[model samples]
Target: MPASDSDAPARAPWWTKAVVYQVYPRSFADSDGDGVGDLGGIRSKLDYLADLGVDAVWLSPVYPSPQHDNGYDISDYQEIEPVFGSLAEFDLLLAEAHERGIKIVMDLVVNHTSDEHAWFQESRSSLTNPKRDWYWWRKPQADGSAPNGWGSAFSGPAWTLDDTTGEYYLHLFAKQQPDLNWENPEVRQAVYSMMNWWLDRGVDGFRMDVINFIAKRVELVDGPAAATGGGSPMGPQIHDFLQEMHREVFEGRRGEHLTVGEMPGVSTDDALLFTDPARHEVDMIFQFEHVGLDQGEHKFDVLPRNLPALKQSLSRWQDGLAATGWNSLYLNNHDQPRLVSRFGNDTTYRYESATLWALVLHLHRGTPYIYQGEEIGMTNVRFDFIHDYRDLESLNHYREAVEDFDLDPGTVLAGVQTMGRDNARTPMQWDASPQAGFTTGTPWLAVNPNSADINVAADLSTERSIFRFYQSLIELRHESEVVALGDFALLEPDHEALYAFTRTLGDETLLVVANASDAPLSGPLPADVSGAELVLANYPADPDAAAHPTETTLRPWEARLYRL
Candidate 1:
C-alpha cells in the first residue's frame, strides 16, 4: 500500500492521476492504404493504446485543412479533413475511446486559422464584409514595408499582404495560418461556441496549441514593441480571455475535462497565473523553458548536451508550481525530435537510456506525457538530403540559409538531421515489416531505417522490455499518492553525469537516482536514504546490496527508485 494513500482525497481531478499519450495522427498508423494516417487508423489502434495503459489520448489536429501546416491550418473547425474521415468518424472514435476508459483530447489551434478558412476568406473577400474585423488587418507603412517588423515562426515576416484586399494581415506562424483577432468579442464567442460543441460531443478536453499568443498587446496593431521587433505578441489580456473561456465553455463541468495550454515563451510566474485553480484559467501548461536549454540562437541551432542546465530548468518549474499551479511533463512531441536520439543514447545504450529517461520523467511531480514511439525507443531519422524533409519550418529555413545567404549546405543540413521536426514525424514502428507495420502503402514520411530492431515485436520479445517498464510506471502512478502529490527536490544539482531527485509527501519519501552518461560512476547517497528500501531499478538488484541500501554505484544510463 502507498504510505500517503490515506491522505489523498477520493475526488481529486481525474487528470492528477492520469497519463496522457500523444498520437501524431499523420505518422501514428495509416489505414485504407492511403499513405496518410486517418481517424480509422487511430481507431484501429485503440486497443494498442489501452494495452499501453494510457489514461487519455491527445490527437493532433485533424480538421479540414489545406495540409499547409499539417492540419493546423484548419479550414473548418467542426469537420474532419476528407483524408482523415468525417465528423461521424470522429464521433465514433470518441465513443470507442471512452468505452475503453480512455479520454480523448483534441488539439485546439485558435491562435490562427487556415487562410482558406471561410472566416478568413470572408474577412479577406472585401473591406465591407461583416467578418472583416474577425482577423487582424493593417495597411502597409509609408515605406511600403510590412505592418510591423515581427518575424514568422516558420521563417519570413509575420505580415502577409493580400493581393485583392491590398492590406496586410498578422500571422505569427506560417503565412497560410493567419492570426485570429481576439480583440473582437464576436471572435471570442465563436471560439467558445466551437469548444463547447466539442465538449458536448463527449471529447474530454483540449491541448491548446500556442494558446498564449491569442491575446496580443495593442502595440502590435501598428508598430513594433521596440526597434528589435514585437516578438511573439503576448500581453496581460491573455488571462482574461482564458478565464472568460473557462466560464463559457467548461464552467459546469469541472474536474471532468482537462485543458493544457502549449505556451512557447511563458515564464514560471506567468504559468502560475494561467494554471492556478483560483484563477479559473487552465489546469496546466506546456512551458518551453526546459526544452529550449539545448537550443542556441534558435531551435535548429542545436548545442551540445548540458545535463546541469536541463536539470536546473526542470527543477525551476517543479519548485515554482509545487503549491498552486500544475506542470505538464514531456521530453518530446510532434514538433520535437525523438528524445532518445537528442538527449540520450540511441545506439549502444538504447534500452538502458530509454527506460532511464522514462523513469526520470514519470517520477517527476507533473503529469507525464508519453509520445507514441517513445516506449519502444524509436529514434531520430537521418535523411541525407533536404528534399526528404516535409516540415515547412525545416524547408523554409534551409532555403533562407542557403539561397538567401551563402552558408555552407552541409553545416545547415547537420542541424536539420540533428533537431528537425521530421525526426518525430517518421512512421511508427509497430513491427519489422517493410513499412514498419504503419501502413500497407508508402508512408507519408519515410520509416526510420532502424525500425526493424527497435520495434514493438522485437522489444516485447526481449527479457527486459521497455513497453513493460512503461506499463509498470503508469500503474505505479495510478497506485501511489507519493508519485502524484509529492513535493519535488533536486539532488546532486550540479552533477554533470548523474541526475537525482526526491519526491516527498507527508512521511513518505521516494528517491530516484539516474546515471545519464555512459560510464560507471559512484556518488554518495543522500543522508535520508541511508537505509532505504529498493523498490525498483532498471538493472538487477543485488540481494546483499538491497539489505543495507547504502551503496551509490550506477552503471551507464542506470536508474533506481527507493522508499525511505
Candidate 2:
C-alpha cells in the first residue's frame, strides 16, 4: 500500500471515506490502434487516478463476450475478451493498480449470460440435455403464444422461441442474453466458483449487476395487459440468494471485499435488508430512486428536472440507512447519462454547477463513485444521426419506435439525445487535439463536439478546474470524520432553489449550502453559521461579505462549505 493509506486515524470499514472511480473500459483509453480501450490502457492511467485520490477503481465487465450488450453478455467467465486483451494483461493491470494503493472491483453479472455461453448452448441443444434445466425454458399455450404476457427489457417478448428446439427460453434483455435459472443448484455453484477465481487473482471487490434480478418468480404468474416487461426485478427469494452468495464468495473475507448491488427498483426499506451488516447480503446498494425522477414512463422519455423530489428521495436514503446499512452515492455510470447535463446546468454555468453538484453529493453519508470523464466536467453528446449510436438500448428503442410503431423520428431522436447511454460512452477526452487525444485511430464512437473545451488537459491547466475541486473533496473525505461517519440532517428539505444540509460528529459540525438554479438565492441559515469558518467557496468572497463569509445567500450556482 502507498504511504498515504494510513494517513487517517483508524476506522472500521475502509470504504466509508474512500472514493471509487468507475471506468467503462471501452471508452476510457485506447493503447493499441484498435480504437477500443483495453487492460493496457487502464494500466497507463494508474498515476492519474493515484493523483486524483480515489481509493478504488470499479471496472465495468471485461470478460469474454460478443459485445452484444457492450460486455454485459458474457460468453466465458474465466477469460478476457480478445478486443480488451487477455488474462495476462488483466493480471498485470491488477498488480500495477495495487502497487499504487488502488483496489480493483470487477463487475459481477451472474443474472444472465450470452446465448453463446457453453452452458446456454448445451441447455438449448436439446430439451432432454443434462444442462437443459440451467435456463428458464417454458412451453407455449394451446394458441402458441408466449408463456405469459411478459415483455423483454430491450423491446418485445421476453421469451424467444428456439426454432430447432420448439421451446421458448426467457431472455429479460436482448435475445442474445438469456437470464440464468438460479433455481438450479448447479448454476449457483458455477457463479460462486467464477467469483472465487477472480478473488484469488487479487481483486478487492465486485459491483454486482442487477443482482436482485437473479431470483425471479418461479410460478411464472401472468402479467398485466400492458405487459410492463422484465418481470419484478426484486423477486421473493432475493435475500436468500444474496445470503447464500455471500457465504460462498465473501463469508470469511468479509471486510476485505466490497460488494455493491445495482438494484433499479429497490426501495429504501429493501435496501436496508440488502446492506445491513447482520444480514450478510452486501456492503451497499446502488438505488435508483433519485435517478429515475427525470425520466417519464419510458427511460428515454426525458422530462424537466425536479429539485424538491430529488432532495426528498436522497434524504430518505441517508436517514433510512443511518444506523445499520450503507449507501453508494453516484450520479453517472456506464448505463446512465452525464451528471452535469442531466441534473445540473451544463451550458451557461458549466464549471460552477458542476462543482456545486460535487459538493452536495460528496458531503452526503455514503461511498461516492466518480465516473470516467466526470472529473473534467464532461457533457452529453449531441449526434446528428441515429446510426452513430452504439448503445444497444438506444438503438433498439429508435428502431421499434420508428419502424414498427410509426413514431416521429425527430421526437425519438430528441429523447435519446437528452437521456441516452451513449452520451456517457464517448471516448475520454485527453487533450484539445482533433481526436481529443483519446486515440490515434478513429474512435469506436464519435467524440463529443465540445471535447476541445472539456478535455482533461484544458481542465488541469486552468486554475479553477473541476478536477481540482474533486481532488479537494476526496481529500476532505479522507481527513474529516464528520464528513464520513457523522449523523446527517437535511435542512430546508422543501426549499426550491436552495439545497442545505449538515453533518455533525461529536463537537464538530459541517454545513453545505448550494444554489441549484441559475438565479441568485437568499434564505435564512439553517443554523447560526455566524461564527463558522468558510472551508470551501467556489466563488470569490465579495469584499463587503468577507467579514461574514458564512452567510446563506449565494450567487448563481455558488456552493459553500463551512465548519464550526
Candidate 3:
C-alpha cells in the first residue's frame, strides 16, 4: 500500500489527480491467437489495469482504418475495425473497465480521414459532386505544378494530382489521409454527431488527435520554405471552431467528460487559452515543448538532452498555467520512443531511471499519463534491418534521407533506431514466451527481442520492480492532494543533472529530487527541506540517518520525495 497524506485541500474536477494509462490497441494484447490484439484482449487485462491503480485508459484509435498510418487514418468513425473487434466487443470492454472503476477515453482522430472513407470516395467521384467541397481541391498551376508549395508530413508534396478530376487535393500527412474542410458547417455537424454518438455509447472522454490542424488558414497559402509541407500548426479560426465544437457537443455536459487536444506546436500562452475553463475549448492540451527537447530541426535529428533547457520549458508551463488552465504530464506515447530508452539509462540503471522519471512526472502539478509497458520499464526496440520497421513516418524519412538526400544509409538507420515510432509500437512484453505472451501466433509486428528479460510477468512478483514503483506513485496521487493541486516551484533550475522541485499547498510542502543521469550526485538540501519527512525513494533510505540531514547523496538515477 502507498502512504497517504491528509494535509491538503480537495480538487473539484474528477481528473485533477487522475492518472491515465495509454493503450495502443494493436500492441497491448492478443487473446484470439490472431497475432493482433483486439477489444477482447483489452477486456482480459482489465484486472491488471485496475491493480495498477490508473484512473482511466486512453485507448489509441481502434476505428476502421486501412492501416496506412496505423489506426489514425480512419475509414469509418462509428464502427470498430474488424482486426480490433466489433462494436459489441468494445461495449463489453467499456463495461468491464468501468466495473473496475476505470473510465474509457477514446482516441478521436478527425483531422483527416482515410481516402477509402465514404465521404472521400464521394468527394473524389467527380469535380461537381456535392461532397467534392468536403475536401480541399485546387486546380494545378499553369506550369502543371501543385496548387501550393506545402509539404506532406510523410515526405513529399501535400497536394496529390487526381487524374480523373484533373485537380489536386490536399493531404497533410500521407496522401491517403485527406484533410477535411472544417470551414464547411456540414462537416462540423457531422463530426459533432460522431462525437456525440461515442459519448452516448458510454465513452467517458476523448483524446483528440492533431485536432488543432482541423482548421486551416482560409487562403491555404504556402508555408515557409523549410516547413514540412504540413501547413500552419495553428490557424486563425482554430479557437472559433473549438468554441463552436464545445457549444455543439459539450456545452451542457462539461463536467461529465474530459477533452484533451493533441496540439503539437502549442506554446504555453496558447495552451492557456485552449484550456481555460470559462472558454470551454478543451479541458487540457498536450503541448510538445518538453518532448522536443532532445530533437533538432527534424525529429530524426537527435540532439543531446539539456537538463537546464528542459527545466526552463517545464517550469514555464507550470508557472504559466498555475491559475487558470491545467496540464497533462507525459513522457512516452504512441508517437514517441520509449521513455526509458530516450530519457533514461535503459541498460545499467533501467529500474532506477524509470522510477526517477516516474517520480518527477507524477509529482508535478498535472494529470499524469503512463504509456503501456512503461510501468515495467520497457526500452526501445532495435530492428536489425529496415524490413522490420513498420511505421510510415520512419520509413518515409528513411527513404528521403538515404535515397533523396544521398545521406549515409547507416547514419540514417542509426537515427531511426534512436528515435522511431516503431520503438513504442512493438508488442507489449507480457512474459518470457515465444511471442512475449502477447499472442499464440506470429505478432503483426515483431515483439521486441529483449522481451524475454524485460517483461510484466518477471516484474509483477518483484517488490522493487519498476511496475511496483509506478503503482506506488499512482496510489500516492490518489491519496495525496498535494501531489495533484499543489503549487509548483523549481528548486534547482540550473542543476545540470538533478531535477528538483517543490510542491506546496497551504501548510503542506513536498520536495521531489531526482538524479536524471547515470552518476552519483551529492548536494546541499533545498532551504526549507531540512525537517521534511522522507516519504518515498527509489532506493530504500537509511532508517537510522537523521531526517534533517543538511546534504544528500543520490545514487545513479535515484529519486526521493520528502513531505514537510
Question: Clashes in each model (backbone N, CA, C under 3 Å)?
Answer: 0, 0, 1
Candidate 2 lDDT for residue 14: 87
**lDDT tens per residue, model 1, 466-500:** 99899989998999878888888998889998889
Candidate 3 C-alpha lDDT tens digits along 414-510: 8999999999999999999899999999999999999999999999868778888888999999997778788899988998998999888767888
Query: Residue 270 of candidate 3: its Cα lDDT?
Result: 90
- What candidate 3 gets wrong by more than 4 Å, as runs, is 1-11, 222-233, 543-548
TM-score of each predicted structure versus truth:
0.97, 0.96, 0.96
Candidate 1 RMSD computed on C-alpha atoms after optimal superposition onto the true structure: 2.1
Cα lDDT of model 2 by residue, 1-564, tens digit: 111233323544889889999999999988896789888888989999999999999999999999999999999999999989999999999999999999999999988999999999999999899999899887766678777777777888788899869988888889999999898999999999999999988999999998888988765533442233344745789999999998998878744788999887888889899998889999999988898999898998887888989998999999898877898999888888999998888999999999999999999999999999999999999998899899999999999999999999999999889888999999999999977888888889989999988899999999989999999999999998888887788988888888889987767889988899999876566766666788987888745345554444688999989897
Runs in model 2 with CA error above 4 Å? 1-11, 221-231, 547-552
